[model samples]
Target: MTEITADRVGGDWLSAPRAQAVFAALADQGFAAYAVGGCVRNALLGAPVEDLDIATEARPEETVAAVEAAGLKAVPTGADHGTITVVSEGEGFEVTTFRADVETDGRHARVRFSKTLEEDARRRDFTINALYARPDGQVIAPLGAGQLEDLAARRVRFIGDAEARIREDYLRILRYFRFAAWYGDPEAGFDPEALAAIAAEGAGLTRLSKERVGAEMKKLLSAPDPAPALGAMAQSGALARVLPGAVSESLAPLIHLEGQAGSGPEPLRRLAALGVRADVDLRLSKAEQKHLARLWEAVDSGAGPAALGYRFGEALARDALLLRAAALGMPLDPEALSEATHGARQSFPVSARDLMPERQGAEIGAALAELEARWIASGFTLDRAALLANLRKK
Candidate 1:
C-alpha cells in the first residue's frame, strides 16, 4: 500500500496545525501514527471529517506520554480498550494503539496491542474504514484487497470473512447497513456475501445492548436517503429482527417528498414515515415518542395541514403531512407545507374567564369547550364577544 500525501487530502482541516501536531508529536517519539478509519475515508470522499482518530504502533502509555510531552492534555478515555483521547487546542482526537482481537464474546473483545498497521486494519469492520493516512500525506491500505477500488466506488464492504467479522462483534451488522446508507452508491449494488452473513448471524443481534442497536438505527434513519439500504435490510430479514414492526416500503416515496420540501435529515420524521410503532429495542426520547403518537394519528385520520399543524405543532405537523403526501402520491403543495409549518399556530379568542361566573363549574367548562370548538370550526376567526353572544344564546 502506498502512502497518500497530505496534498491529496486537500481539506484545510487535514493540514490544520492541531491535526498536524498530533501526527508530529507521535512521529517524534518514533511511533508510526496516522489519522485512520473514518477520518481518512471521509477526507478521501471530500466530505467534512468530524473526528480525527489516529492509529499508532505505540502503546497506550506511550501515546499518553507523547501527547502530554507535546504540551497537550491526554485522557485515557478507553485505556483498557487501547484508546487515549488527546486534547489539543480544545479539539480532542482519539489515538488508539494498533490492536488485534485475541478472544471475543460478540459484545466485547480481548485485544492484544500490536506494532503492525496491518493487524489493526484487519480488525476493522469495513475496507473503507481501514485506510490510514499520515499527516505527511501518505495513505496505506494494508489488509483490504481491492480496498482502494472499493472506496473509490463508494462501496461498503466487510473486511475478510463476513461471518467471522460479525461473530467478532454483532454491532458491525448494524454498522454495515448504516455505512451503506451513508456512503454506498446504490446504483453499484450491494455485496451478496455481506447480506448472507447478516441473515446467518441475524440471531446475534439480540445479544447486543438496546442502546447500541438504537444508536445505529437513529444514524441509519438520519441518512439523506436511507430507502435503498433499508430496503436491503428489509429483504435480508435484519430489519425484522431489529425493529420487528417497522414498515420500510413507504420510505422511498417518503424520502422523495422530503427532498421536494427541501427538508434536511430528520430521524423521527423518517421513522414516522414508515408508520411503525412498537416496544422494540430502539431507545427514543419521551418527546420523540409523544410526537410519533400524534404523527401517526394525524397520518391515519388523513388530517389536512391546518389540523395537523394545530395539534402537533408546525415542524412535526409539516413532517406528518409530507409523509401522508408521499404515501398517497399527492402532489406536494408548497402552500400546504407552508401552512402546516406556520398556519397551524392559531390562537382562539374565547377563554374560561369570559364564560366564568355566568356558567359555573361543569357548565362553565362546557361553555368554554363549546365556544372553542366553534372557534376551531371557523378557522379561529370568531372573537371573544361573538363567542360570548353565542354562549348566551346557547
Candidate 2:
C-alpha cells in the first residue's frame, strides 16, 4: 500500500467536479474504489491525464446502478469486459470491476471479475500502469510489482514475464516501444531483459491489425525524441519486423532541426522522414496519406521558400523548408524562412475568372497558370495588371 501525494501532480483537471463525484459515488456503494491505471500513472509522472478510470470491487451491473443512482449516466462502453463508463456532469469516467484474465489468445483476453486488486494488477501489461489512486490523491500500489519505484525511475517493464506478457497480447511489442519513446529514461537506458524478450517476440508484431500498428506508430513518431527508442527497436530487429524499409537515422536530424528551429515535431513529417510509403505499411487516413504526399513533394521540389509557400500555403511551406534544411544539414536560412512567410501571405495575382471570355477553357487555365508562375518568379511583386499584360503578350 504505497501512498502518493496527488497534490504534487497538481492541476485543476485532476480535482475537477466530475472526477470527484464519480469516485465518491463508487466509494459510497460500499466498494473499494480508486482511480486506476493510466490516469494514476500519468498523475504520478506529472503528465497530462487524458482519461480517468475507476476500479472497484463492485460488479459491472452494480457499478452501473451506483453511478445511475448518483444522477449520472451509465454507458456500457465495454460492459461485457467488466467496464461501465459513468458519465458525471457530462464527463465520462470508465468504471470497471476488478478482473483477472482467465484466458488470452495473443489478441484478446477473457477476463473474470474479482474483488481482489492483486489479480487485477497481475493481469495488467505493465507495472507502471497498474497503479491506483484514491480521490484525495493517495495511491494504491500492489506489493512486489515495484510499480511506484519503476514509475519514479521512468522504467517501462512488463508486469511479470515479458515473453508471457507479449504472448498474452502481441500489441505489447509496439506498445513497449511507444511507452519507451514517450516515458523511458535515456540515462537508465532500456531494460535489457525487456529488450531481449521483445527481440524474441518481435516477429509476433505481424499478427497485429494494421490500424493498431498505425495508431501506435503515429503516437510513437510524435514523441519529442523518439530516435533513441527507435534506435533500440532497430537494434532488437523490432523496427524492421514492423516496417521493413523504415530507418531511424533520418528521424534523428529532423528532431534536432525541429528543436533548433523552436518548432514542435510533426508526426506526418516524421513519418515521411522515415523514407517509406506509409500508405502501404501503416493504416493512415486518406488525409494523412495526402499530407505525407504533399510533404514529400515539397521536400523533393527543391523549391525556394517563396515558391513552396505559394504552392503549399504558409504553414506547410514553412514546415517543408524546415525539413529541407534539416535534410541538407544547413542552418535554417532567415532569408528563406522570411520568403516562405511572405509567400504564404502573398496571393497569386491572376485568376481564371479574370480571363473569362478573353481566354476560355484549357487556354484560359494554361494562361492563368503561366501568369501565376511569372508572378511567383518576380517574388510575387507583379500586380494583376502586370500578370494580365504578360498573359496577353503570350
Candidate 3:
C-alpha cells in the first residue's frame, strides 16, 4: 500500500506547521510516516476532515523521541497500544505505530509491531478506508481485485475472513451496520457473511462495555435509515444480548419517525423506542441520565402547557415534544411547542403580596396553584384579572 503524502490532503489540513513538523521529523528519523485512517478516507470522499492520525513503522519510543525532537509535546495517550498524542502549538494529533493483531479476545486485541504497509492495511475494517497517499500526491492502493472495486461500488466487505474478523471484536458487527447506513450503496446489499457473523457472535456483545456500546448505538440510531440497521440488530438478537430488555420488534417505526422529526442526536429517544427503562446500568453520566429522565417524564405526561411547563423546564419540554414528534412522524402543534416555551418564560402574574392581605401562607399557595391550573385549563388564555378573580373565589 502507498502512503498519503503532504500534497494529497489539498495542502489544507497538512499545511499546518505542526503537521509538516510531524512528517519532517519522522522522515528525518528514517521512519515511514503517513497521515492515515478517517482523514484519508474523508479527503477521498470530499468530506470535511476533523482528526488526522499518523501511522508509522517506527516503534512507540522512537516515534515519541522523533516528535519531541521536532519541538512538539508528546503524551503517552495509549503507549501499550502503540499510540502517542502529539501536540503542536494548540493542535493535537494522534500517531500510532503500525501493528498486526496477534491475540484476540473478541473485545481487545494483542498486537505486534509491523514494518510492512500491507501488514498494516490488512488489519483495517473496511476496503474504502484502506487507501493510503504519499506526500507528493501519490496514492498507493494495493487493495487488489474486488476490494477497491467494492469500495467504488459502495459495498462494505470485511477485510479477509468475516467470521474470524468478527470473532476478534464483536463491536465490528455494529460498526458494519453504521458504515452501511452512512456510506453503503443501496444497490450493494449487506454482505451475507458479515450478517451471518454478527448473528453467530451476537452473544459476545455483552462482554463489551456499556460506554462503548452506547456511543456506537447513538451513531447507529442517528443514521438516516436507522430502521433497517436497527431491525437487523434486533433480528440478529444482538440487541437483546447487549441491552437485555431493549429489543422491541415494534421499534422500527419509532426510529424512523425520530429520524424524520430531526432533533439533535440524543440517543435516549432511540433507547426509549426499545422499551427499556432509563435506569438500566448503561453507564451514562449523571447529567445525561437526568436529561433523559426529564424528557421521558414530559413525554409520558402528555399534558398541556402549564402542566408540562411546570414539571419540565422549557428546554427539556421542547426536547420531549421533539422526541414525540419524531416518534409520531408528524409536526408538533407549533402552538403547543411554542406555548409551553412561552409559559415557562413568564412569571406568576400576581404573587401573594399582589393578591393583598386577603390571601397569605397556605391559603395563598393554594390560590396560586388553582389559578395556575385554571390558566392552563383555559387554554392558557386567562388574563391577570381572570387569574385574580379565580384566586378570590378560592
Top candidate by TM-score: 1
Residue ranges of candidate 2 with Cα displaced over 4 Å: 1-14, 352-361, 388-394
Task: Write one digit per residue (lDDT tens) for candidate 2, span 272-328.
Answer: 666765575688888989888888888888788899987888778877877776667
Tens-digit per-residue lDDT, 1-394, candidate 1:
2232333464656688988888888988988888888888888777788878888899999998898899988999999989999888899888999999999988999999998989889998999999887786667778744787788778888999999999999999999999999999898778889999999999999999998998999999998889999999988888888888877878888888888888888887788766665435577777877767776777776667776777678887777778877778776888887777654778767777777677778987777777776876776678888888887885
Q: Find the number of clashing residue pairs for candidate 1.
A: 7
lDDT of 3: 0.73
lDDT of each: 0.83, 0.82, 0.73
Error of 2 at 182 (Å): 1.6
Q: Which residue window of length 10 is worst by lDDT in model 3?
A: 1-10
Alpha-carbon RMSD of each model = 2.6, 2.9, 3.8
Over 4 Å off in model 1, which ranges?
Answer: 1-7, 300-302
Clashing pairs in 2: none
Between prediction 1 and prediction 3, which has the larger lDDT? 1
